[model samples]
Target: MSDEIAVPPRQDNQQWLRWIQAQYGGPACIRRGKRLHDALAQLEQSLARFRQPGHDDDWLAMVRIRLGQLHALAGDWSKLEPLLDADSLRIVQQLYTDLQPQLRLPPAPDPRPDVLRTALQELQEAIAFFNRRWLRHLQSLDLSFYERLIADYNRYYLLEKECLLQSPRLARLGFQPLPSLTWQSLLGRFPLLPMPRLRNETSEH
Candidate 1:
């Protein structure tokens, strides 16, 4: 009745997690759920918001990537411009502008050990809070795009991956159907926030 994942005794077993993820989707059938990307594309296209035709462009996908960059402090956001149309770019710009005030940090204070430790602890807490809220919001996002991708995988992933085997039945061998990806399944792969360096957390003891 619940979507929360249950772990086996050997939780580190990748094969077990993959199998569980596969079985945890919608009832096995071809094309069970609607495609999110196509539906969004149709709506945006009707509004004439897209400049490039015939491209698999999903503005929300781009939005998520850029947002992740902002959170992770990893990539160059300006470089994202050419990948989007003018209107879509405008949306991204406004979003960044709005979030800037909340995300901006006052310059780091004294870099002494005590201050640094406190800062690290506070930053980690903030990330944990953001992680929960971010994941919940993400789960609420349209599943159509990812669902369709998984459905395609459900349909053809094995054949493509195992084509070298050269036997259709062998290609299909030992295959189990994977459902659309769920936040829970993603959680299964990575249950902890990665960056405060989980391993070193115990080193302090």
Candidate 2:
């Protein structure tokens, strides 16, 4: 069924896969707590493909997400700022959305359970990897939105884990700690907020 997708005349399919893998490796390197430039270069190649028209949406989505990860890795606020556009932000939102149990544990008797698990794990690992790199960038941006984003992500992950824990069919799926960050820690590292607090201090008195 996938023979065609498996082999494209332009070789775009395979090359896209290779690029995604390279981007993935780049982020893994950052998570390993090593220098980030080499990985950044690999990610740049992945993103370069996006400049060409006619790229697949799924592939473009990956490139956008990978660029976000790369920006976070470099701690280049100026560059990272542009990469965190609505499309890239949506990718971040979907990372937690995909983890939803009803979505993952779909009624049994379905074939390819292993494939589903693999897909879920790959995304989870990507989010985890991104989170670690993102926290470093967040530390510098001092954005309240960053705090809210991380907290919401952590909450959703915990909720999803609990859902998995109660699934009799999937209970054997084991577990992993929820991703998180603290306000105190956030404050300690990045004392200034990226946004200014707005108050409706109107003269009513």
Candidate 3:
């Protein structure tokens, strides 16, 4: 008798597409990381080559902000983890996961519109949760550290917001910008929280 051949189970187009995405997505993520690293290197070279007189500080500040953004794109959590305690770090980790696709360069041809829409909704939910809980989490921590971490989060958030706004695909997916954080807004939201301790207080104690 002739050997029997094993037939694979049939999958619908959407199922097959999802399978392909899952299989290829890992390498795609690596490629995206490489591209971002390259772009950051190029930006650094440009900054070095075109340092304008009298605008040195401005240029440096802009480049540092861009570097922070690139670090986020690369998922360099080390930059943040040291500044946060375990609970706050966990919140930031989730926020970064949601923000990643929005920050990175878009994949060509894009995912299906439905998939993109669902992702945007999920991202929005993550941001809302972070906004609601982050300040509360900060209240028990060292005030100076809280301010530093919040500042870093705000910078990364601004960069992510700008990327989403600039992407036509993201705009069509109904991405809405999160409100920018400021000292006044932060105080307003958590008015009763004790002021972050001053450096001298720690020194004196």
Candidate 4:
């Protein structure tokens, strides 16, 4: 993806794009961890651009707010620091306050009106990030974090589901719940036992 975000003047979309690109691998190499890292990096660039000179205040505010959310989704704690830092706390606090309403909306309708397939892939990547990592964090957090994380996940998941439901192109896809209980059963049976790897059958002979 291009690093140019096409934001208003003094908006270093290029810089933001560069930072974001730094987090992910080339198109062929993009994986879950790399995607998460790239998302956070993009978000941070959005945050940094807000403080740069000549940027539109309203646009910057919106971008940073969304960036916070993207950061939250990607588990980018480092990006949160600016918001929590004593000097920037007020800005951070207001960002969250403003973000609450925006979060309620469905995600930007898959940008590709012509190609629903690409949009489906985008949604899958977005959801897979939560299923693999963020959801686990949500399930394990202390009361406070759990509440916040689950709410975020719920909103995101519902939005994705809504899009899928509306898309006639995606009618063939079926929902498959992940196996969460299997790991626990294995742990219960083995306690401290190390998992064994399968050996090659031919090697045994």
**Top model by lDDT, which number?**
1
List, residue by residue over 1-205, the lDDT tens digit for candidate 4. 9987644335364664454456443221224324444544554464345334346632233333443444344343343333234433344344345434244443443323233333223333433442344235334533443234334443454345444345534632553322222333323432221111112212111
Candidate 3 local lDDT, residue 55:
47
The reply for model 2, stretches above 4 Å from the true place, is 1-111, 142-205
Candidate 2 clashing pairs, residues 3+ apart or interchain = none
Q: Mind sharing the TM-score for model 1?
A: 0.30
lDDT of 2 at 118: 38
Looking at model 4, residue 30 earns an lDDT score of 27
**TM-score, candidate number 3:** 0.20
Better of 1 and 4 by lDDT: 1
The TM-scores of all predictions, comma-separated, are: 0.30, 0.21, 0.20, 0.17
Q: Which stretches of candidate 3 lie over 4 Å from their true place?
A: 1-105, 141-185, 188-205
Q: How close is candidate 4 to the true structure, as a TM-score?
A: 0.17
Report lDDT per candidate: 0.46, 0.38, 0.40, 0.37
Q: Which digits, one per residue and each the tens of the lDDT, describe model 1 over residues 79-111? A: 433333455445445544533323234342343
Task: Please give the RMSD of candidate 1 to the true structure.
Answer: 19.6
For all candidates, the clash counts are 1, 0, 0, 0
